[model samples]
Target: MAQAKKQSSIKVKVQKFGTALSGMIMPNIGAIIAWGLTAAFFMYPHGWFPNKEINNLVNPMLRFLLPLLIGYTGGKMVDDDRGAVAGAIGTLGVIVGTDQPMFLGAMIMGPLSAWLLKKLDQVFQDKIKSGFEMIYNNFSLGILGMIMAIFAYFIIGPVMEVGSQWASAGVNAIIRVHLLPLANIIIEPAKVLFLNNAIGNGILVPLGIQQAAQVGKSVLFLMESNPGPGLGILLAFTLFGKGKSKSSAPGAAIIEFFGGVHEIYFPYVLMKPSLILAAIGGGVTGTFLFTTLGGGLKAAASPGSILAILLVSAKDAYFGNIVGVLGAAVVSFIIAAIILKHDKSTGEDLDAKQKEMQAMKAESKGQAMPEAEDAHESVKSYENVKKVIFACDAGMGSSAMGASLLRDKFKKAGIDVSVTNTAVRNLKDEDGLLVVTQEELADRSLQKTPHAMHVAVGNFLSSPKYDTIVASFKALTQVEDKPKQEKPVKKVGSIDGIDFSKVKEVNFIRHDQHLGTATMATSLFSDAMKKAGKTTPVKAVRINELTDDPSHLVIVTPAANKNLAVRYSDIQTLVVKNLLQDKKLNEAVEKLN
Candidate 1:
């Protein structure tokens, strides 16, 4: 168990680092596409139109604008706008001396510069006094930015140039040896683990850009961006797979092939680990064909969509590229079909796989293992959730698909909550918010919005959690909309250990393990009171945050009530059979002054 935990922790850290690296590049993909289009349409000799004047936009964009954008974004990830300024400044230093674009340098110096600036502010900001605060802030950032830029110019530029040369040489050597296809042995598996962007943008794009600058096109751009492998897997599932995996594949395939959201197919691969072989097979075949037939793209295809890949293909390489993509799909589809045919498991196989993945993901997040329960009965509350957010590592494809799925569910249920998607790093704590994240990213999402309700899912597209959320919300909506007999407010003369008039606030105690449950309970109780037309404010708070005042009413289970007695005497307390659905809560609400 200890070894497992250590390994999981290492994996999480690697994914996080990869996400950060790709995060810098992912946002700048539009700029890259623009450069690619410009080069393809207007470059003096090779471009379709051959316009020398307009072609000037290509090199400068790649050499200066793109790298600077990456640096600024990377710095902002570390410390917001000020960090963005410092990062761009530092990146300029690295670009000035190198003929090669400074992508690798920007990735390093941007975040490092911003981190240093943040540390300096933490140390000196408190000491700066009175009206001179503006002077301290300005001088501090200016001096630090200048120092970072100088350091990057002297140290980072030359180092990254050598590194780029070495990487390009390694790729060239692999191609020369005809072993390029075998690279998919690692690439296919890494893509499944959500490192596609890191591999594509963090490593391949910079190298491909360098190669394209000299040779007009490069195979590196197509290596990771090719949608063949994923399309193959999804097609296989569509034909031979059983259950929801079978039903969901066609849509997933469309998204993977045309939409260029490669992440749409990852969950399918994860459902049956052996399907990785199909991906590997497809990737190897595609690379082999591309290499032997001389297929290459003039620029990185941002989404690896068929249309995008073709749009950026070198004029002479279209045949090779098309053949490679189709050949990959055919080979992968055959292998996956065979695998699915030989397997004798029932339809429950997919569900079992989902449960296993969910368990592993829960363990990775250090969250409690998910036990089986009906969503309709298990969900305790549906109050004040004004919006639902689906968050993931990149906030690009997977989360967006999940958001769309839930939005459909909401529309069908007639629920009024807004649904959206964003990167986990961008999530903010807000009132009446419900955050949905893949299980692996749950811990980060929770940390970002500690007060909001959270749901961790294993499969973004088909997790049962979505159904549970819809059912719970629908049930509540029906209850609220249904006609009910008006009941007379009970006037309690007295109750043990209680002062009704002094009850200004109600709280549910939330400990580490039960924070989510407590949050739901508070919402449920608050909604119940609102239906009864009472106006008392209800909250979920840790035991330590609770005030020891007579006006605050704390509700808890018998176990928690005992724990609370040991900590405070002035506050009123109610012990309940069930914290979320106790009958006594309504009585307590009625007695409130």
Candidate 2:
């Protein structure tokens, strides 16, 4: 029975792995469509819209909007509002930091951010209680969301950018300064173990491109036809794989090599870390073979899969490709077999460590303790403690931003409150602590504290929604304040002579890659508007100076389309869209429109 249970567990794990892998690939379906469309227009200039104009519009839209949409949707599916907000913020971070277009950044960062946020939320969710909800629901949650966004922007974004650049540079330097054989020997190992595709393409190909072009060959042709790390993995499996896993190894290698899904081998490698060296050895061998055989590819072969290589390789390099693939496979198999002979079980230790960590977390959060203790504590000091503390991954960026925003809102409403930012782990004893985070981070220790409240802020801090939160807190606290009447706004005219009554309002989606606050707002507004049967164009605009002109409107026309330029002057009202500032003008425009 125990043996059967273990097999069942392994089967379940495999099933989950397959499902996740499939899901990850599904997004690429849309990505391929976008890539194909863009490639067609770039390659065939006379096919559709004017090449230059189409290029300009399509690039920005794909880079920014498409990724944002996909990420937001994915996040929503994962963790609802909070995940959606995090996805949007992560997409913005990628856009601001990378020189690459938004589409690629979004593709990578959106899911990554969502995953991080979800994980963080799970780690901190249980420590909050209902009494503290007054504060948790008010400002603490938003503050936490902001902190997470900032962490992603400053830490993750820059590291990825620098890493890509450095890897590319290092690869090129090796190939240029050393002999082709020596260079391959070094690069192959790095690619196999570290899975550094950026280094391979960014550095290796540029050198190969220049070398091939100089020698009267197409740069693209050389890159496309080249066999890469995939071949190395295959070689290792062919020689080393034996017994029950032998057949699985060759099949897995072929899938990884040809399908360009490098992750397929991760389980195998994880099961035996010594395979790292073996894979590296194979990689170096393959690289040497590739250079010697004059193997090259025209385009990048992501996943280094055999199929991707074949698709991108030059027509005449078929023999060179086969030789390189076989060479890498043989070398890797020998290395892996030698390494695996000395390998031991590492999963048992890892499982033990995971359990230990969970226990520690439970203790720290007070979940393992009794409920009566918490009830007794809450009753002891129910009236005197009036403060709420907000904790996040980092106290600097989002926490600070959120705290400041909430502070202003609370002050404006004449609600007296105190708030501070602290790392989640640093949170200590407080009278009425409200722990605001994703559901994942709620701790039982937080609940046992008697006055603690856990409110999940999903992600992304909206000032308007937070204002309502402050209002709720004020009501709960019985703070006395007179309500102010809504101010009347001057009516603005529209150019189309369409009934002003039909137009609801004009709003701007301001974003600068640091925080996608604008995109989140726009998405919310659009969703709300669509529900109400409203339609409006969301235009992109550049804001040069904050104080340039409150009344000045700048109209941007498509390139070489002077005929459309005069249309702006003919309109009575201008709805400007700047993805930077959150202001009353947006509301006014929305209302007027």
Candidate 3:
């Protein structure tokens, strides 16, 4: 059910291009690693069986299998099944023409071939007749695949070979001279900007695994995986930061250092963009030390976790790796602290912005609900209410905290209700349950659990609405809505101290309010009464339209605008609280003839 995430940022095309590159490589990394391991164990100069038979498997794997896999992955990204087929076919030409393995060539042509076919389909797709659709699909792909294969062999394969060799030479020269520190210029900024996941997991890890297999270790493993930069930044905040950041920095540091959740520190750096210098300084310092000491690991330390790194350490370089990490952290922390002190950004603004972000983040998952009122109200009884639940996307973080806060509030109020948190997807319709979520998600939550009373808040952490809800719970015990007999009671059907019956028309009045809760509630209640065989017209009118007419039953919506209602209360009147609840609505309607 996971759709491709929409990317709208124009700063770089990385979300599309970088993500596609990562997607193509990640799925086949296991196979690539398997080939590398096979070569190391059975076909290398140090292999037990260094014979021609072992060498035979190696060449075919490098030339045919690897390139085809890359091509298939690349093509699939562009145009699914047909793209994969075309990519594989085009890559075969590269495999045939080149004595050397066409790694780079396969990557380029795979997605390129897929993209080319996708364009062809876009052009011919509308023209193809319904009955001949299958034939068109098959023949078009076949012809295009043949064309790309021929083109790859004659044109692209040779040119890519030279380019790959040149890139390789440049990289080797940089590594040899220990100018690898220069890489931090790009790496540090990318990591801070959240592009590190693609750079590390997609590109570096697979290549690192290949290198590690042949030489028993690879410095490439440490390039993007070093956690020192983020760790240093978080540590700096923990020691010398200001405002909400100072309070939050310790928790962020613990998670980043021990849990390897580097994203915890991203917001802190983003608060002050100049802090990127701290990251780069740390990255360069760590990488330089790692390169100088020839520090590496036997495998990719995924998560860039220090514990994962230590567990996969290459022999004779463990101490050097540890020393490099420490050096990076200390240097980054010092620079970050200086930058933080010099920057004059206000803490209150950051705190407010952070809260806004949290609210906005939850809001993005849903849309505003229709304000149109429902004619048939199905209000769930709170008489036997046993539990309340807070529901959200993941259920573990914000929802859980909201549930806990509500639970604490209930305890203080002496309410014997059980409160819990759950994922929205896990909700089941049940009686005596209350479902609370952000207002934006309220509609979805109601759809999932219509039997439960749905409550919504603009924010979960702190809101005044919870207090109003608790007061409502107290009133639940005192009020009992039932069909009335002949005898009339004083102040009956009172909502915020206004009641009405035995009037010619229930005139709904709003001064300047547009189509909202007032308009909706009036339309629905009026329609319902008309359906129930009541002859009295339910009229909508403006405040200025009303006269000193005692025949009219005037009611106001949001009923909090009591000042407006007081202006015309001489006649029968009802001030509807926030909404038209079924119980209160029934009492007022049933009281009529």
List per-prediction Cα lDDT, in the order shown: 0.82, 0.46, 0.66
Q: Write the per-residue lDDT of candidate 3 for residues 154-193, one digit (tens) a residue.
A: 8898887677567556666888998988888898888655
Q: List model 1 lDDT by residue over 238-288, tens digit each.
A: 898887788988988898899888877877777677889999999999999
Measured over all alpha carbons after superposition, the RMSD of each candidate to the real structure, in angstroms, is 12.5, 21.6, 18.1
Question: Model 2: per-residue lDDT, tens digit, 1-593?
Answer: 45643653453344333323223323343453344345334423432333765556544554565556655655654555566677677767765666643333444555666676767655643343313323332344355446645765677667766765664466555555534444444444433332233334334443333333223222222232234444454445456554434445576556556655453454355445567665666566665666666665533445456776665454455566667767776776677766655545432332233234335444544454222223234433222335545554323333454566667777888867676665443454544455443222234225333345444332213223354456456555554437879875543332343344543333332223412443444455555556656565332222311122223332221221132232222222433343333353345344543
| All candidates: TM-score | 0.78, 0.34, 0.54
Worst 10 residues of 1 by lDDT: 369-378
Off by over 4 Å in 2: 1-58, 61-81, 93-171, 178-278, 289-304, 312-323, 333-593
Give the poorly placed runs of model 3, Cα more than 4 Å off: 1-9, 12-14, 32-66, 99-101, 129-131, 201-217, 242-251, 254-261, 297-301, 307-320, 338-350, 353-593
Give candidate 1's whole-model lDDT: 0.82
Q: lDDT of model 3 at residue 444?
A: 51
> How high is the lDDT of residue 552 in model 3?
69
Candidate 2 lDDT for residue 323 = 75
Query: Which number leads on TM-score?
Result: 1
After best superposition, candidate 2 residue 443: deviation in angstroms?
A: 22
